[model samples]
Target: MLELNFATSMNDAMSDTMIKENPFSSQPTTSAFTEESTYQAVCKSAVASAIFAVLGLSAFLAQMFMLLPILGIVFALLALKAIRAYPDELVGKGAAKFGLLLSAVCLIGSGAMHSFIYATEVPEGYRRISFAELKPSSRGTDAQGFPKRAAELDGEKVFIKGYVRPPSGKQYGLKSFIMVGDFGDCCFGGDPAITDVVAIKIQSDDTVNYGYGLRRIGGTFRLNPSTAASDEEEIPRVFYEIEADHVR
Candidate 1:
């Protein structure tokens, strides 16, 4: 009878030991070692998520890096998964979610901005010209000012990119405005030279928001006779104007 009792006590102790050591057991006796490993993974994930957030925000600096925001979002998602898998041992779930949110925002905002800038594809067959293409010389009506190539573009449907002078009111969809090579030269402070300016007349009811930026304008090009005065000198101003159809 004593031997039987000793054997039973030994079996009970062994069963308890097995239960404590079994990691998958319903009643787990978790150790500091397992928790430490999980915490380390959580830390790594959190740091990765933070890195993603920074990259996503800075992605706007270069058009080629537009995919960075998506990459950041992916990293944040992986971090969240790590946190979820070791909920009892790991932390930073909140951080991971916040990182994901920031990444998504950056991605969407960057996409919208790109669309705004590039949506207007310069229509095919439209002649492209620049202020320098006018070949403006020191004086108006100089042969150099109206090059042969520029004269050929006159009366043709052409596209030009430049800044517009803001009207008196912050108007949208202006019917007419002065187009200039440099905003500071015409509207802000300095007197605008004739060759540096073009008068734009819009035919379509396209509402152009008055602001400062390089905007593409499409219209029928013309050489109009316009003049300006400085110190009682009838300074020759811009001889170019456009019957604008589109301004964006």
Candidate 2:
């Protein structure tokens, strides 16, 4: 009888312990979950706003090129969404508002710069010449087979109209330039037959949408006779050059 009593007591104790360990016995608590969500929202807003602000500044610096300002506007708008989501966070609210302001400044500055560069009359000494006027002797070849047409174009101002072909292979650089005519053979960095095509160097290091259709540009023309080669051999040649004081 004593042994049986002891056994029954042990079984009862075990059952009680199992009941306490059961997860369903306790009520669910969601305080942790709510806190985590709030923290994430605040962080997201702050980060997004900060990024937009930086992009806006970049746009301002490159406003002269018309590319940076446009990008800044886009990033600022995105930041605003994040800020609105986390209104409680001071950083998010500040950053979002700043980004919007920066974007606006970029747009206004870019427009003003464009007007200044393009609207001003070409200087008296700058003559409007054509591609046919370029001397054959001005063309020279570098070690990489890239032509040095600018040497022939020294001290001359010419205006040539052509399609803006983005640098292919290895020719694209930080500066803005384009190919004028369709060259018979497309070289690594340039098209040879379309000698009329020239690269226009923009004053600002701003990124722009170059994949769009052809644009017409006018500027004072000069050339530098130097060969720039990259690891890629088939880099197209950047010959025939124009310096557009303004691009339309």
Candidate 3:
């Protein structure tokens, strides 16, 4: 009986030890090494940067599209910053770098090309002029409030670049159109400031298609002959008009 009791106690102690060291025990355990999640999310800004970079390829087409690459550069910087701030949770540093590189290339290359064109675009006999030169005189009321610069250039062959203001549901095969220096002034729905607008009449039976990019025109700059007056105000028909001999 004593032997049986001793064996029983020994077995109980062994069972208790086994229970304490059991590998498959149901009790909660703390691992010395915790596993990390392998999945990482791409930064949204990084993705946007890449997308903008792709769209920025169009920057070569026109200067207006240069904004795409500029936005891409901004978004790429933001993405890189976010990825650095959240190292473990966010990825896409490579994508951000790619976006940055492509955007830089597009911006620099297109900018250089546009600058070159701007430098050499005027015809040999045409004088390069800007919209700023056409502003009315601030000091004197001479030339019907026209600036001296504009009056000097009157009937002179001048080369100017401007955006075509879309017409009111009439854009196809146009012989004439309104021009503005700033893109924001384009109004299909409303008229821009009278002084800021130019009436362009295609000469030599030439016609122009509707477009939004800068149009390089070599023309005879002139003041409108019409000084038609409304009941309340005197209004000159367009502040300026271009008798365009060359359009491109």
lDDT of each: 0.70, 0.52, 0.81
| Off by more than 4 A, model 3 | 1-39, 81-86, 137-143, 187-190, 228-236
Estimate the TM-score of every prediction. 0.45, 0.40, 0.75
Error of 1 at 6 (Å): 69
Among all windows of ten consecutive residues in candidate 1, which has the lowest summed lDDT? 227-236
- For model 1, what is the C-alpha lDDT against the true structure? 0.70
Can you give the lDDT of residue 227 in candidate 2?
A: 31
Residue 31 displacement in candidate 3 (angstroms): 9.8
Question: For model 3, how does the per-residue alpha-carbon lDDT over 149-184 read when each residue is reduced to its tens digit?
Answer: 777887889899888777656688877887788877
Q: Give the candidate number with the greatest lDDT.
A: 3
**Model 1 per-residue lDDT tens digits across residues 112-168:** 887775555567767778887775544344354465655677789988878776655
**For model 2, how does the per-residue alpha-carbon lDDT over 124-243 read when each residue is reduced to its tens digit?**
445544554443434555453434454444556544544555444434343565544433222224534434546666654433244433344556565545532222223355445565
User: Mind sharing the TM-score for model 1?
Assistant: 0.45
3 in model 1: Cα distance from truth in Å? 76
Ranking by TM-score: 3, 1, 2
